[model samples]
Target: MLKWILFALCIVGIYFFFFKKPKTIHEKKEHKKDSIMLECATCGTYVSSDEAIIQDGKYYCSKECAQC
Candidate 1:
């Protein structure tokens, strides 16, 4: 009986620790609204602003893509 109780407690603890329902992906992304997202001018692929190169108020994923 003690072993069964211990096992149940352990299961509940694990469930709370791992599956307590943190923010969903959309919620987390929406939380960072001020952060910039750069879209490829040519191909329209989305990339993070930090990874993009800025020139003339336009964001480029790479110099090669920018040239095309």
Candidate 2:
């Protein structure tokens, strides 16, 4: 009886340490989508494509920079 109980506890410990811990750690990681980068035509600053302003075939960091 004692041997069976010890074997069960060992199996549970192994399962928790090897399987459960890694699953939770992987699930908690934040995955960000890839973004394109473009250099500002005025100041030469790099900005993400989504936030950049496009004008006359050039990319700008902001509306003010685009006008300049």
Residue-wise lDDT of candidate 2 within 1-68, one digit each (tens)?
Answer: 99999999999999888776544555754546566899999999999988999999999999999998
Consecutive 10-residue window with the lowest summed lDDT within model 1? 25-34
Models 1 onward score TM values of: 0.44, 0.50
TM-score, structure 1 vs. true: 0.44
Clashing pairs in 2: none
- Candidate 1 global CA lDDT score: 0.80
Report residue 5 deviation for candidate 2 (angstroms). 46
The reply for model 1, stretches above 4 Å from the true place, is 1-35
